[model samples]
Target chain A: MDALKAMWETVPPATPDDLARARRRLIEEMGGRRRLITVPRLLVAAAAAAAVVIPLINGLGTPAYAVTKNPDGTITVTVNELRDPAGLEAELRSVGIKADVSFLAPHTRCAGPRFAGVDPSYGTRPHTEAELKWGAEHWRSLQVIKAIPAGHRIGIHPEYIRPDETLVLEIRDDQNPKVLWTLGAWLAEAGTPVKPCTPVKD
Target chain B: MTSQVDADDATLIGRSLDDPEVFAALFDRHAPLLHRYAARRLGPSEAEDVVADTFLAAFQRRGDYDRGRPDARPWLYGIASNLIGKRRRAETALYRAYIRSGVHPAEIPGAQVEDRLDTLAVNRPLARALLALKPADRDVLLLVAWAELSYQEVAAALAIPPGTVASRLNRARIQIRHALEEGD
Candidate 1:
């Protein structure tokens, strides 16, 4: 057993170049969004809510995103473009829900257990397509963001979210207008702060 | 001020959320040992892919990482174990090849020729015994022996109960002893 421990005691650590290669791959995969993140940022803290509904003017002049509180206590977020997650989060907060939102570019996703999950929705990775369908995609644990078939919007069922839990959303750009976008939603465990979205290869 | 260096695994993972590149720091911190461990099971070439894939998977699942655990070794190793399990045949092949040739291609030969002969004699039998053990048992035994993870850490890494880790480990050790005795 002791000899087993010394079996390959000398295969030297991975060289800098090896690690550099992997790191370069990671950075390259994040290239498109990495650059998007560095553009002169908007000082959005104090004036956050306004940004949510009336963000950058798409060439056609629609607000980047709009949040509407429905009569049923749900929130409808009509996204004209995937931008201003900070503002969206603020808007959701103002609508009386704690939230974290990340607008991801194509080919990216926020790295996970970004927050402690309130339920099994974020507990384990589904092993099969069936598990995925029955477990995460259809469960109550998720619903912070659900596509509303008629248009480019999402429904936030605050009823599914608890007082201490946060509604976490990752909205990724699908590029094609017909598709609009795809989203991932989760509830961070009560009392555990959701980490800021870190876009990485999907 | 080596602040990043001073930060624990949980802190680095937390910070990486806002600054995604900070995750590369974690790869730098842990990849070496992870690479070596994989190499021991699957050879250098396969090990490279395994380590890369492990880190990539870990990155994707980083949000689910438990922050209460300051060190990510158990978590990372657990991920690596799953990846390696997928290549169980390759791991078994490595052991069989070492048993047949008394050579681990990845092992660096030491200066003592006489000592090398004696060590190989023992290692050859160990390799054979390792080859014969079930993949699950081998994972528990090797994690404790080569990775130096404690019983609790082994349980966490394999996502098994501590009692299961103990039973598997004891079962593996007994099997190794029986195989080695047969070899003698």
Candidate 2:
């Protein structure tokens, strides 16, 4: 048995050529360092561009938008306030589209207050408050619904809007749940009268 | 001043990142044992892939490394095991291929005639037994038997509790020994 063990231990090791090939293959797959640097460099350039463009666009606080799911299971529309900052969700509801409105934070160029209202059921449940608070603080609240029946627009707004916040609006179908849409803008409280946005077609 | 024997793996890895040549030294130190282990399960062709993938993944994920753990062998083995798991079909194919070919890649040439035959006899059954065991059990057993990793290292490599490692190793040994005794 000992002799058998000794023989078993006498296996030959792999060759250097194999190791070299593997190294080369791995380097290729990782796209080499040359490609990796490009992304960070591009980000730096974008930041520089933003620094220049931000001041000119100041006071145009980012717009808040809403996503609405129509009752007929037809479609969801993303309403952005920057371009059409009116009663967008109300219009959609008037057109028989059930809507969910979400207000995102604004950019420095376009600052606005932000607020979010989650269902009390989410926070009031035992052993769930901590989780709900954590989610609310760190991530956006996702409102789930059964189906957007006709004539009801779900209003989504931040708990309160703050300066330099971008308002993001997301809409989803109640049935499939995965059917969703999003619109984002910097909220600008320029006292611009909220105009009627053109009704979105299915 | 650092001996290959004494230098911890993390230190070696850190040095290797700065000086790629230092990596070769690590390869030289660990690859023999790892290759032998791979060769036992996978023939030479696939063993080469396992060794290469192990180091490459290690190099890429080095930033997330826990430097406090000085020995990198278990870590390397863990990565290699993951790579091997992905190629389970390939590994099984190689074993099936070996059984038909009557050749094990790492089996040394020019060994004593009787020893060679005994190795073949012992290993053939062992291979069959290994193939029959669950992947987890096989991993723990082979790391101990082939890689000579301690139960702690096996636990680290397999990411199982040490007690689990002991239990699996015991179970695998019994099965392997039984298979060998039965000549199955």
* Candidate with maximal TM-score: 1
lDDT of 2 by residue, B91-119 (tens): 78766775666576666768777966777
In the range B119-175, model 1's lDDT, one tens digit per residue, is: 777778788888888889999999999889999999999999999999999999898
Q: Positional deviation of A58 in candidate 1, in angstroms? A: 11
DockQ each candidate and list the results: 0.15, 0.14
Please, what are the lDDT tens digits per residue for candidate 2 over residues A1-202?
2322442466666665656676455444332221100001222344455432111122455434345444544344332233343466465555443333333222111111122222211111121333322322232222222223222223333333333332233232212122222222222222322222223322
lDDT of 1 at A77: 85
Cα deviation of A37 in candidate 2 (Å)?
13
- Stretches of candidate 2 off by over 4 Å are A1-8, A26-31, A34-202, B1-6, B16-24
lDDT string for model 1 (A16-41, tens) is 66566565565443332221111111
Clashes of each: 6, 33
Model 1 bad stretches (over 4 Å): A32-202, B1-3
